[model samples]
Target: MRRDQRTGDHRHSLPAQAPGPGNLPLELTAFVGRTAELAALTAALETGRLVTVTGVGGVGKSRLAVRAAAAAAARGGAWLVELSAVRDPDLVEHAVADALRLTDHTHRTPRKVLVDHLAGREVLLVLDGFEHLVEACASLAGDLLHRCPGLRVLAAGRRPLDTGGERIFPLAPLPAPDAAALFADRAAAGLAGFVLDEGNEADVAELCRRLDGIPLAIELAAGRLRALSPAQLLSRLDDRFALLTGTRRDVPPRHQTLRTAIGWSHELCTAEERLLWARLSVFCGPFDLDAVEYICTGDGLRADDVLDVLSELLAQSVVTREEGPTGVRYRMLDTVRAYGADWLEATGDAARMRRRHRDWYMGLATWCELDWFSPRQARVAELVDVELPNLRGALEYCLTEPDETHLGQYLAGSLWFYWVGCGRLAEGRHWLDRALELDGDHDDSRLKALWVLGYVAVLQGDTAAALAALQECKDEAERTGSAIATAYAVHRTGCLALLTDDVERAETLLRSALDQYHELGELNSNVLMGQVELAMALAFRGEIADAVVLCEDVRQVCEDHGERWTLAYALYVLGFAAWTRGEPATARELVMRCLALDHAFHDLLGTVLAIELLALFTAVEGDPAEAAVLQGAASRIWPSVGLPLFGSGNFGRPHALCEARAREQLGDARYEDCLAVGARLTPDAAVSRALRASSGGKAKTRRLPLHEGRAGDGLKQGELRPGQRA
Candidate 1:
């Protein structure tokens, strides 16, 4: 997520895109004048397993690594893990796993999951903004290189990881001519119909040369074209330089140079723009107009005129617009933001602005959590996805600031949907654990986070941890006299029971939890999922008629409310019922629908379970080879998810039945051969094969529920792993 800013030379932030192969961010701005650097970096990647691109801040080291990775790392897809916003060393692997789109259901650490995933894949890993986490990055990089023969590490930072066999690719500033060309490019974009010509050519060259040929400095200078001629800009730069002279002789000359460039930009902004810029520093990630208006305006800067000021900043290249997951958004270069932060600190307003920033994200998480159950679920997902960096930033602020643990707990609990539903369970657990470690006066917030911790721990197959958290939550609820918290505790306790193969206890608890949800008039993704879990319990207990009735009722409710996540699980129950009644075609169609939703959401638990059932249906349809292959693919997926079939007699029954039948039909050797072949396919590839073959050999992503926003969990419906019996 590095914005490819000047590494380690200044403050840094993140970059975002609308998802890509390995979720590599799209370079928002056109990469200017890096042909030679790109070539050399690519060649270095060709020769070494680890290449650390090092340079001063503003030297475009991150940008070069990204370009090189895109060019040469196409075979295994380029995965970029942004580290500037991540403060916890333990979360680094979590960030990498998330970027690589891995969703493991096991209690294993992210490092183990990453190593297992990378062992045979020819993938490129880009580690951006690693200077702050040098030791962690060095350890991870070395371990990954030693273990994964097909892995290449392209790291961008101010300093090298210094791992053994590391190739440090030191990046220098742009050459004088290239600097001027970059300025010309940025200037022309700022002023329509503008171009570089003989007039003012020398002035532009002098500006680039005087600015040390740094791309960021050149671009900032170019942003002045609307107000100053090239000569006039150079004149101001000279004045700003004279005013900024300091006695810090030990500072790197390049640091001083880059500082002067950013300082000059700050000095030129109007008073309102300056105030806005300083306030804007609180945001370390991409922001949209609504956010700017909400968080950056109102104190001396009027909300009505925020857009005009924003447009002026955009014109000045202090802020640049790009496509975000939600829509059009703007971002400030990290170096510029650092300057603003310094000014904000000097103005004695940093605390206030930070509080404001936290409040905005807190509200966002709360609203998104509530909306996650409604028809606006997809919109909520997209918004949270886009705002994750800032959200993480805000979470960091809450956890690190004194007397803010309660708020941190609340925020962590509020993001349960994003953590569980949006495929960030490990990270969610990380934050929740941290937030819960310190005592807060607010029991409600603490209890909320406690239940959420139990929920995630259950899905991760950590039954002991799950029991501890749920027990604490229930005890705290009764002590506080909170019925809502008590109900949530009861619900997830049922989930734990469901996952541990106690279907009778699970059924009773789930049914009781559903009645509690009804009595309290609670309705969200969580509430709907409680109902679906109840149905799963009934199906596991061999009460097919009741399971059908319950699931169908849940499905109708899902359709009415535009809730697809819970609906997927409801369909899974009906699909199981359909299969039990000897309707193979109907069962396949229903489970395929379920798989489509799970795959779309990166819900690995649901995905593997669906694939398991699909294998059984395929077997019934007389394709034992494909069925065995599907089972093989499921085997490949299970480690990432958790224990295969959750180690539940009930949950494992479907898979065991499929394996036995497929083996009987194909014979042991033939079945084993097909299983090996299917196991070779990646998770996405296996799902693709399953989807196409299920659809009569037709590609079906578009036609599936995904295009309309599909993701669901039937086994506690993501509140718990998929544990229902076939």
Candidate 2:
């Protein structure tokens, strides 16, 4: 069974309240004087498929693009994908996928997944900070436009993306009066009772003029109001930049002015604040107080001092803070981060600080992975979601640094569930493959990563890769005497066997794995899933009663642990057992319940299986038309999963039976029409329709067990698939 592409999950997870808007960041402070630019950008978006907002850093191009995107999102949907932190051209699509919140599980390329997602939608994509990845952005914009007719691209960069059909909207410095007004507003925010009046009005105006009307420089300069008067600020700028002297002709004037403004801010900071600023540059994404306390501590900076110094830096506009889902997170603008990075490099502590940063995230991933099976599973996913950029940065450091390859392997091993459960199989494989190849160590971490690789390959339907990885894991386990590694390898081998229709071998392997898990007291999501797979293999081999017992045990354990991801799989196996028992109503209820849990997590494999089972029940219950439609929908999703029915005769039986029955009863034309109808329905709508069908057309209420007891208790169940025969 295939996993749901992150694109589908991303789309489903969006806020349902306003389908009209996408994930545009809220404009916290007042948009502060971009009226003309906003208007022009909005007009450009109307007339062009691509609109490029081009300007040097700090010219307010991003602000303008955001304002326009929000407006467009109000009409349709607009998503903003920030590209400033993305350094690799190969990762451009992944960056976009992250922005779209696409957790695709398929082995398909990120670009293909994104294209499939946007193909039929009318939405706007705001690519912010595209200057670093201009060529990649241009190609992406062109391809997206070609694939999606209704798609619009809004790019913000120092230079244009240069995609064909782009309407370039050049964003210059804020006009003189607007810049002065911005500085005055910022100054008032910083220093109470400050106003733009006759006293220092000329000095403020001259300061803004000297700063080249760059919004960031104006804002940073304004932040110095508490210590420096407007006249003093102008004098400092003059002394720093030596405006009377000849400026570098090759370099841009605006860049020089902004750099001087930022440099002056840095020079004025206290020693502790300066150190904190430099150390804080290690974070590639937003960070919380706790993280800052940990990563920036030591070497003359105590944990307690970080808060006060952080506030001071915030006052200086070196870091921006916002309340996020978890808590308040702080981030530095690209220009600010660049300045701090320079200082960090100069301090010669860049390498050590980076290692510390990687270590912190590695520890974080370990903690999250250990907690993944508990009630905090959802929260863990959310936490990992927020830290992905930082995590990616850490991974890059570990993989690129020769000495850190082992740590990279360990980190990749620790994030198995996040990569597999969260629909990042291809990326997970990429990291694990690289880390494993770079180093050859026979420890617990390497073993763990090997099993994870095998599992991921199995999900991708690469039997050869799965077997090769599992064989290596098994051989190493025997050599190293690691029982946990042996058990895990055995479990994944069972999964591969089950997927390949070797039910007997699968059942044997799964039983062995379960025994080891029991002996070791290992009760995680992975172990629980092993039990569920055992039940599936039993059911496939006509051991329906025993399968029911195993599934019930798995489900009870999952409920006891408050585990949802594994419970969904248990329900699926149980639902399959119920369907074979010839109780259509019982089967329908169980399958629909399973389908709901699958859809909730965007688990595509579980979802399609439930749907296929539901179709089989409908066929036996005499609603062949609806069954045909459901079958058609499942058919469309099968390709994305890599294998249809996972090549399992047992899993394939119901789908094949349902199709045969529906086609025979409805004939070709009517069957095709009904199929098309089902195909047209979105995944959510299809699930809803299937639930309605399962409920026998009454208002639906969810129930756990389909019947009083487990299946095969003289229920006259007959096999619907290839393997089972009742």
Candidate 3:
């Protein structure tokens, strides 16, 4: 489905999207002067299974690919995976998975997720900014093209992926007319009353020609309109272009042109602007003013002058203003940021700026974690989602530097809310696993990371990993005398017990953990979640009344603090209790609320549980056919999440009962047919159908038609829902 390109946070709303219909950002500015290129690309992709638009930096490859994919993939849709910010080769698959928005709860490799999701869909996979990950991309694309018959790979980068059967479309500089038109358009935006009129058309053409017709170059040169006219700009550029290239054999001529253009723009910037530009290169993704102020200030760039200097950069087109869910932010194009990075390195300030960047994001993560415990929980999710790239950069910095392992552990441990609550379990595992491999100086930080890893593993149904991590954390915490670490270790061990269906042990351990938390005066999402888990254990042990009472208390606290993550779990337990007591109406309302919160937070496990529960409700409502379909939808999602019903008798009973009833109402063949219908719906479509089915649209009416494909972007994958455990 189409999302507003302006609100970038909307793109980050889900954990990444499950493969669905197309999602291409609506171009903010008009796509100009690529008519032939667009036509050629469209034709290439139409006939070729793997087409790469290769060009030097700033030659409009990405832009042209986006335009072509949008047009060519009209039937199945296109999914854009941006790899510029992702540095690790191993994460190339994860980056693609995130782009496709696969919400798998299991520890399955990202390659498996992509192959499984793409095998059936006729979708164009657009991999932009992937030059840095060429080998990985080549491997992945080769595998996908071999397995997914309907899939097409459209990649944009500086070089070819060099895979078997790959088609390389080397992009050249725009012709004179198109380049001049691009300048006229960007120049008009930068300077008032600027147009391609008889007065300056020739000069504009000459300027674009000299700039080598590179889009980024043209845009940057156009920014000079505030200080110089087209004629004046041409006069100044003649001198600059004379020595722009001809001797650099290592770099392509187009690359040289791009570099020369950027260097000229750099030369044009004021000293403050140039310094700020170099400093700003430290950011991996779009950054807000608050972050820039915190990390980019100082270092000869006065704090108070950051705003003015940044404004000058923005005005000069060095930094472009972009909006996200959090409001206005700024971004530097990849090529420009690269140039700034080179400048930063030349100034010998690269390491310091990188450290500052890491520190700011670390601070941001800490604050967001705290905010996660308050009513600003949803807002925190938004901010984290928007800053994930930068946060990932921070985590990499800490983990890569030998002396910073402790900080890496702390950072990973601190983001438990984002990892578990926001449904980033797999990616969280990637970072935590990496952080934990090295020994940190601070045992407490490592212990915290250990417990969080255990908690995530429990959710992913990785019993061995969960048990090992938790046990080690307990042993280390006890040895180090860290009560907080011990408390979390115990708490997550209880979670592992619950997932594995050891309800009695779960109840005992969870109660102990909660006590430890209370004694330590620890009241946060984790403590409340421990309470909720205890209630689940109680519910599993047939103590429905006690479970209800405990969850009710947890709910009250969560509401008081505006906490939704723990609140969702509490609601799940309470809703199940309500259904047990035969209050179907109230049960539906409460569970629906839980589902809404879970989906909003991109909690795959929570969303799946709600869907499963609603399907059971529908079965009892005399619409066995509709109920069976919902069950099929849940079944489709369970693989991504891990084992269905968590292999727990308590959780499985409801699903079993619903299936039996549906079979009785509709014969085996009819019921199986309904299941197939539901299974065919994309993950997001199924959730949408489930939510709609749970609403006034009753089982009998079944007004909403379950379809085979996705309508738009949605949460389609699954993991263990909060109340889904035994």
Candidate 4:
């Protein structure tokens, strides 16, 4: 439900220009037989800006809306957001933002970013399969329509959103003729050489009628033709409907009919396949073969047997397959998943399956964290990207279950890199805060969560919260004798000090943390980054030689370890030191590399700092015009990162020097013009410009190696300067 919980990793699709490249899913099969409904829905859209296509489960509302939206795409740029997988009402905005391919670097609420982006655009937004999120959808649609005069919404759900200006276009089941035609089409696909004629017309029509003309039900019934004859299927349908006597009386007949159809399909599946279906329902979104194997196996079904049964489920249309850039993943329709979940509960294996689901994703997070500091960093990020929804589901189960709070804390704390490196600081804080609030003793997991919370709060410029969390983390670490937790506590405390310009204390804490890391053999990205922070602190204290040497050591270790996130920070300090040492070209090279890496991970803070440094280097290299432009670019990104210039001391000096020199050289009016140009650059374009030399100058070809040596050797923990408290 939250943006992070969506099925696919939402890399921005290219913006639609004139609707030539909208993201409507390509219809796999012929959009069988909904001529009248499609026409009516399209007509309704033309008159009403907000149209709700309401129907029961398996009634084809989603298909009808998409068909209408595709037709309107040419004129209004139609986009579809599939909301059945969304479970959290609060994540509705993120769902829409993902579907629109909106990736923002700002800390603004996703809703605000969405509204501001769509304010002037004329587009048709399709909210499909949104019954569970109706209220959230209604609120979002109302706000968007009120803000963007040209925006239109076409929502498909079991009921209406009922927002102002909304018109309910109730969709009935397919007419008999249409339903029969759909049955024959799918039957032909499932059973080769099968033709509907005098041989079976009556039986097909009777089967469709029994299924209540529901498109999904009809399709399921037809798919049985692969083995069962039409006469056999019709007989089976009659018995299935008759067995629905105990169904809810408050529900409509069509609802009962759909459930009976799904039940019949379930009954037809082999026992192993049925078990797999029930287990697969554990996933809230698409899942890969490996996940199915890991979570859906046991209790007489071996892990390797999953693929065979899974393929059978696919053949029977119990599960849907989608192929994306990552590869093939399977999903169940909400209706089918609901049926499976019911059976799963009935079987009394739901709790066991949920725990398996949680364990699998927790292992995945652990693997990703391990790989994050290796050459597999980018691929690891992509894999983690695809698993976010499952991760969210796991975390949800952990936090809500009385016995699983500690697991939730561990899971949230373990994903610090994914949250911080991937532009999800606010969400990270949300999970960490909730995890910490649960009733539990201060353990290692709580210690980890506390420090991660501190790190996130510091990045958000919430100094009070940051200090509070870190103090608790430090206290818990000492109490529990957790060396790793103590190291993280000391490292993040140093990070906070560095951000506040307490350079002396920062260096002392960082050195203590580094010594602890060495003792603990902590060689992940965090420890490497602790070294980077130490380098920055040393630089701020005017120990340029030692700072450069330390960063060089970090860069070598990162390169050797195949890490980029920590390496980027090392490059930043090394670049700044290079600039101060009168090596303009070396500074540019180092800073540009830093900018590229930061952009790759979407690290706003790193990206902004690098931009500001490049601007200062450019000013001294004599292109005052370009310096002003880069400064403007950095300014636009500062609010997104909070407390832009690190702290107002040596870390702030380069920005000040660049701004004064650019203003003196370019004068006021032209400087403003250049600044405007820089501010206009998108996040991607800003990185591109930083990589490209300004004023047509050739970028420096030769690279200068940063100092490579042991990190501040022979300096014991007790050797800290007087009054320097870590």
* Candidate with maximal lDDT: 3
Put down candidate 3 lDDT per residue, 304-397, tens digits, no spaces: 9989999999888889998878999999998899889999999998998899998998889889988889989998999998999999999999
Measured on C-alpha atoms, candidate 2 has an lDDT of 0.80
Name the lDDT value of residue 550 in candidate 3.
93
lDDT by candidate, in order shown: 0.82, 0.80, 0.83, 0.80
Q: How many clashing pairs does model 3 include? A: 10
Winner by TM-score: 3
User: What is the alpha-carbon lDDT of model 1 when measured against the actual structure?
Assistant: 0.82
Q: How does model 3 score by TM-score?
A: 0.93
What are the RMSD figures for all models against the true structure? 6.8, 7.4, 7.1, 8.1
- Greater TM-score among 3 and 4 belongs to 3
Worst 10 residues of 4 by lDDT: 1-10
Candidate closer to the true structure by lDDT (higher is better), 3 or 4: 3
In candidate 4, the residue pairs with backbone N, CA or C atoms under 3 Å apart (3 or more residues apart, or in different chains) clash, namely none
Q: List the residue pairs that clash in candidate 3.
A: 1-712, 16-101, 17-100, 17-101, 18-101, 105-640, 605-721, 641-718, 641-719, 683-716
Give candidate 1 regions above 4 Å deviation. 1-35, 698-726
Error of 3 at 388 (Å): 0.5
**Residue ranges of candidate 4 with Cα displaced over 4 Å:** 1-23, 33-49, 70-80, 97-125, 144-151, 188-202, 615-636, 646-670, 677-680, 692-726
Q: What is the Å distance of residue 446 in model 4 from its true position? A: 0.9
Tens-place lDDT per residue, model 2, 158-211, is: 988776888888888988767877787678878999978889978988999888
User: For residues 104-156, what per-residue lDDT tens digits would candidate 4 score against the true structure?
Assistant: 43446778878876787788999998888888888999999999888989998
